[model samples]
Target: MSQPEPGAVVDLLGVLAYAELTAFDRLAEDARLAPTLTGRAALARMAAAEIAHHVRLTDRLVELGADPAAAMAPFTSALDTFHESTRPSTWLEGLVKAYVGDGLAADFYREIAAFLPEPDRLLVLEVLDDTGHADFAVREVRAAIVADRRLAGRLALWGRRLVGEAISRSQAVIAEHDGLADLIITGTGDLAGVGRLIERITSAHTERMTTLGLNP
Candidate 1:
């Protein structure tokens, strides 16, 4: 496979960078949904990591001579739509969204990183949420379900809606940004490769839902 043009690489990096920034902000805001101080603190800490990632991405964008804001602008709407459409109604619902959403995102990034060159690949890997975050989310979801078995049904339904909204917004991003799609195809090298990437992400998401006692 050929290396992506420098401009395309910059665009891709910009998207990733901006994604981190928005994620940090969103997570911080969503932390208020937490039922306890501990849960709120955990989410806040996760948000802090996203801020660090945003800064790193911004620095890299500067090194590459691209405007970080401009690079991120194109993606704002789609991402905002996803977050808005799937805002969680309760503390347990929030945990499920974080768990399911971040799991799929991490899996997607892992597959996409395989197609990127050195530093970018390493950067993406570095920004992935550690197992601690996933475990925290899982524990919260499990405890909530155990407290009220009926919650399993509500949270599971909410999780499904969240996934659907996420997919819709993702497809919107793909449709709106040819450059983003190019990055994926160029990195992976074909439609089949893209499909495999999605398959892995979806499978991981399913497993995460099951682990939380939710029907995928």
Candidate 2:
């Protein structure tokens, strides 16, 4: 018989599976706020990509002998809360949220994946790849900010709010999921290492803000 998968690995994949699925939902909703047909189409395409990634994660969960639904259940509340709390009120805010949230999650997951063995690490990184939306967000947000200089300040504040909400939700999730916490601690070799990991993620977020012409 095949050996059972590690709990930490299952936790990682489970959370990611739910995250991708919710991202699909969020993007589809955001697409409705698009000012132009082209913008709507772009977000629609990105939403499709999110669903595809969700399927990939669910498939891997099944192969590991876990029910995809059960694996994702634990994360539903936390992720949902995060989304509801950060729902964008405007088209530009939606675009900024997508860009900033995706970047933050990608950075955090990439750091955690470093601790995972072989195929799991590869799978996590693969699903976390950009769904071709970053450049679109950058172009859209920057153009809007140029037309209305006040938007730069507003979106900059929005970006900071997104980061804060994401990090807070993540910490709650980590505390509740011991396996996930252990994975991070083990991968980092200690609490201090985990701090460094957060620092790196924060640094990446600052760079993403700069790329969008927003204040970090």
TM-score of every prediction relative to native = 0.93, 0.97
For candidate 2, write residues 1-216 as lDDT tens digits: 222239888999999999999999999999999999999999999999989999999999999999999999999999999999999999999999899998899899898888888788899999899998899999999999899999999999999999999989999999999988888877788889988998999899999999999999
Model 1, 176: alpha-carbon shift in Å? 1.9
Which portions of model 1 show Cα errors greater than 4 Å?
none
Please report, in order, the local distance difference test score of every candidate based on alpha carbons: 0.79, 0.92
Q: Which runs of model 2 end up more than 4 angstroms from their true locations?
A: 1-5
How high is the lDDT of residue 107 in model 2? Answer: 90
Candidate 1 lDDT over residue span 5-34, tens digit each: 676667667767877877787778879988
After the best TM-score superposition of candidate 1, give how far the Cα of residue 179 lies from its true spot, in angstroms: 2.0
TM-score of decoy 2 = 0.97
lDDT of 2 at 176: 100
lDDT for position 61 in model 2? 91
* C-alpha-based local distance difference test score of model 2: 0.92
